[model samples]
Target: MPPPILVTGGTGTLGRHVVARLHDAGRDVRVLTRHARPGESGIEFISGDLLSGRGVDAAVAGVETIVHCASSFKGDPEAARNLVRAALRAGRPHLVYISIVGVDRIPMASPIGRTMFGYLASKLATERVVAESGLPWTTLRSTQFHDLILMVARKLARLPVVPAPAGFRFHPVDADDVAARLVEITLRTPAGRVPDIGGPRVYGAADLLRGYLGAARRRRPVVPVPVPGKGARAFHAGANLAPDHAVSGRTWEEFLADQVGDAPAGG
Candidate 1:
């Protein structure tokens, strides 16, 4: 039998869906996670921390395709470095990385930049690691996921007044949509920096939050607040949008309706 495909962060918001697609396609999948998990049919869970080098070599052993979906608010480049080092020792494998769209466009250089936009810098560094890893690689940069937007909306809704960052907009796509694309990339020859994937529509911060609140049967006033810094300033110029590549199905309203409750897709 051929070796299984390895998916880092196979249990995360995006990684789990990638694992599911591979499993459904009759491909054996190995998941590398920081925490211990039980293996299911055709899907084996390997306990390995990407932040450290532990268990990573074993995780990469005999795998031809590695879908790198694991990420954090910080330390993403470190994790990618660890994975790259191990992959080099193991063998040449197809490394497919998932990154956000504005990692390159945003400037994460100052105090506010590091505080609010540091994650973009980390991801860009990770992308570099993958590209220069001496292995065949494919990278996909997507807009914010529906799950992420949903979480933010839920948190801000807890407050009596939700502070919507002015001039910020999102093209939130479904995690499953991204996972499907990852699976396609995994099964195909390595394509460097594929065209971005974004949601069907773009929604402003206030509109997005209002949609979620309406879906959840909650009412909260969304007030616009000026976001500070050059990074945010760059983002306000639509660094986070991908109108040309808005090929993914599943709108924000659709996801919110499903997550919160029955409501109209339009808010």
Candidate 2:
């Protein structure tokens, strides 16, 4: 029998898909969550909190592989450190982490870096922990998820005018696709850091907002707000895009279409 694989953040957007894929494959899958829930079917639920390191060791016991998917803009660094310690104590499991693209390129020393500091810093710290943990590990850096783009668009749509960061571009990949890749990675030997998985195409923030508005059948004028910063400069320079390595299927338009359905009858 294959050793049970423990999955942190198994209840989240991407983690849920990973759990489902692993469970369907008939693998011994265990999920860690803050609240204990009754196991359904063959899936096991282990109660644990990555932030406080509570119940973590118990969750790692007997598990040979861990897919570290749980992350927080505020607590990721500490949580990752805790998870690494627990894994080491429980016999150095193969650790796989999901990270965002362009973190390496984003300046951690500037004012722009300080703005989105929590999230970027935490994730960078987590990556370092996984790398230096002396355990077999793999880290997959992927671009922003399409759902995130939609969330921002929805929130901005509430305003009188949709304001987009000028010169900002994104290559938003689908969460499910990223999840599938993670599953594939988990089944193989750790490959350390792999090529980034990005969306089918790159689009500027204004174009993205227009796509969202078109799909939702809402008309809103997009105003470009120039955000001057090194971070913004990096994003504008395509640091967030893996054009040479555009991987994964599904485009932002496809995702929007699925979510909003067919555009209202074109006049």
- Best-fitting candidate, scored by TM-score: 1
lDDT score, candidate 1, position 74:
71
Question: Candidate 1 at 206: error in angstroms?
Answer: 0.5
TM-score, predicted candidate 1 vs. hidden true structure = 0.97
lDDT over C-alpha atoms for residue 116 of model 2: 56
lDDT of 1 by residue, 1-267 (tens): 778999999999999899999999989999998889789999999998988788999999999999999888778888998999899888989999999998899988789888898778888999999999999999999999999999988899999999999999888999999899889989999999999999899989889988988889887888999999999888799998889998648888778777889766576
Report the C-alpha lDDT of model 2 over 1-267, residue by residue, as the tens digit. Answer: 888899999999899989999988889789999989999876899998999889999999988899999976587878988998999999989999999888878776776667754477678888999999888999999989989899999999998899999998888898999998999999999999987888888888999988889888888999999987777788778878878767659888788888876533320
Consecutive 10-residue window with the lowest summed lDDT within model 1: 258-267
Q: What local lDDT does model 1 show for residue 224?
A: 96
Clashes of 2: 0
Q: Which prediction has the highest lDDT against the true structure?
A: 1
What's the residue-level lDDT of 211 in candidate 1? 91
- Each model's C-alpha lDDT? 0.90, 0.87
